[model samples]
Target: MDERHDPARARWAVAGLFFIVGIVISTWFTRIPQFKTGLSLSDAELTVALLAPTVGALTGMQFAGRLTARYGSAPIARVTIVLAPAALLIPAASGDLVTAFVGLLVFGVVDGIADVAANAQGVAVERQLRRPVLSGMHAAWGIGAIIGALSGGAAIATGLTVLQHFAVMAAVTVVLALVAGSQLLPAGVDRSQTDRESPKRTSWRTGWTRRVLALGLLGGAAMLCEGAISNWSAVFLHDELAATAAVASLGYSVFTVVETATRLVGDGVRRRVGPVPVVRVSVALAIAGLALVLLGSPSDIVWLAIVGFGLLGAGLAVLNPIVFSAVGHGSVQDTGSADTAGAAIAHYTTMSYGGVLAGPAIVGWLSGAMGLTAALACLLVPLVGIGLFARVTAAAEPAVAD
Candidate 1:
């Protein structure tokens, strides 16, 4: 039952699940403007409705760790992955703002649970592989996003209804989830159980260690940047840069393609340069990219925004993998139980979800008050924070115990 005996299968399964997650999320994001118009909502009204998902995600994060700890990640992943896409149909078919809010709330809860389960599986597979495969697995997600954005754009151009588009996406995701779930390691190989049997169980209190919090903060900032780009890039292009709807969709496609490419090589980069330096450089690139986005909006150079988004995507490519890997490596103290490790990951995930949940609403509010350009500029605060904290915290990563 040891997954290490067949690490290759486990790795592929985990990667595929990550891909499905990406597709589900990106499909919803790329169609946000359509939803707004269909519901006849203002930017601020849309922002308010969007908060429903954040509320659901926060609620789901509270319990996903414990559920994964008790049930094993594969089973939890199978159920949540299936439920996430099915839930998407609700919002896609909604005729009113209230209905959309309810649907998004359901989708968010299931999606959040699936997110935690997938990462747990990824960490487990990485431990079995005995190398830096986490980043490569995350790259699968970027690939999925690229495909989703491009396809969604095409579907819209061809006059596909939102309901019809979501139906197709849900079917595809369900099929992929079933196949990938079957290939994951059996329940006996659960990483959480293994940690629970360690000689020294890491106390609940140590789960809040300063190093863990710092890594969580860094990860949260990175997720915020990603959420901003995913949810707003199309809108930014159409509204600020005066691009057409079809052309605006290409903005997200460009960003995701670059992100996928960067993540494809992220594992090698981390091995050669170490995580801290990688994180520092990545944040710096993001800061520079956002600056270009701000400057390009008014200058009427759409290429600048596209190029800047690509750089931003590249910069964020490795962030989640590095942060998750640090948690796995640092959770090696003899005193730590599998529950302790799960708790640590949950804490980190909660912070990251906070950023995701808040990012779109914050951007919408700011854009309504000022302009989209000024709204995006606020990302510099978190980007700067990532640079300052990346090295110091990553340097403290504990060696994983054999």
Candidate 2:
């Protein structure tokens, strides 16, 4: 155990919590029909109601920066794990829509908080280890998602009901997450910032004008790819391929499995290629993935789409942490305070999270209007956009060495 490191085991614990949260959130999508029926909501009304929870979520994400900066990542992360998993209890217990909405809102808050704080913790842990480790942390998150999705069938089969089931699972998972995350660094402490006039004096404006914009945009595009799959993959499978709900989800399931596996090995891949090449390769893979999905037929080519999405997941997995790493390095290069890094991270996350929140609905609406094929083709624009951005901003600009 590296003495300066925040116990690798502890970080893994945090990783597990984040993974469970991912599972619960994704599972909720499957449960939306039940939610709609329970609430007696029409399609339009359901959409409207769903929007409210995201509103709360976005608001929480926006403020997550200030909260973490002041309060620290570990405590906030702990609270979010508890809060988010706890939110499961409400929907599990309630038979009505109003209560479900409130539960979702709570879910949103925990989601935002856990996401920001965990990333923050990952940064700290990475610096202490003095090597690339974030990919593995994210891989753990993906694995958690797989476990959650797999369990959904069992939960339904057991006949305990969604509410009762989610509540019990929530309580158990949150406690485990809290226990696992206890020894990590506090949120705002920067292992990379040794030359200190104190980090708190730093401001966001100074950071954004630097290369942080490119980093933020890149992170955003990668996030958009993920959002696209979660929201549109099932639709594409169901409508375009005429598959069952279970089969339709196979699209995302394959993507998650491949993505998780790649991420598990991504650290070595990045080490061999470097950030610029890794990003370039990943973006190219993403473009190919999206293209394959667009062109492939359900009868003979659906597996091709699955393969494409899997490649896309692996390609995209390295990005989120890489962006955060770049921001931390930028601050060091500029000889700026670590607080600036926090602000930069906050900005990048804002763009990335916003993309995810918006990508599905936007894709869905476009699919409704122009057809699923056309909507899938629409995704190509962003892929091209991201590719061009990566090429132009290709150089990592050499970390401003200490």
Question: Highest lDDT, which number?
Answer: 1
lDDT of 2 by residue, 18-59 (tens): 677767775666566766776677888787668756776666
Sliding window of 10 residues with minimal summed lDDT for model 1: 393-402
- True-structure RMSD, every candidate: 4.3, 3.7
| Model 1 alpha-carbon miss at residue 291, Å | 3.7
Error in Å for residue 158 of model 2: 1.2
Error of 2 at 188 (Å): 6.0
**Model 1, residue 402: displacement in angstroms?**
5.2
Question: For every model shown, what is its TM-score relative to the native structure?
Answer: 0.81, 0.85
Off by over 4 Å in 1: 1-5, 29-51, 89-103, 150-168, 188-206, 231-250, 294-297, 333-337, 361-375, 392-402
TM-score attained by model 1: 0.81
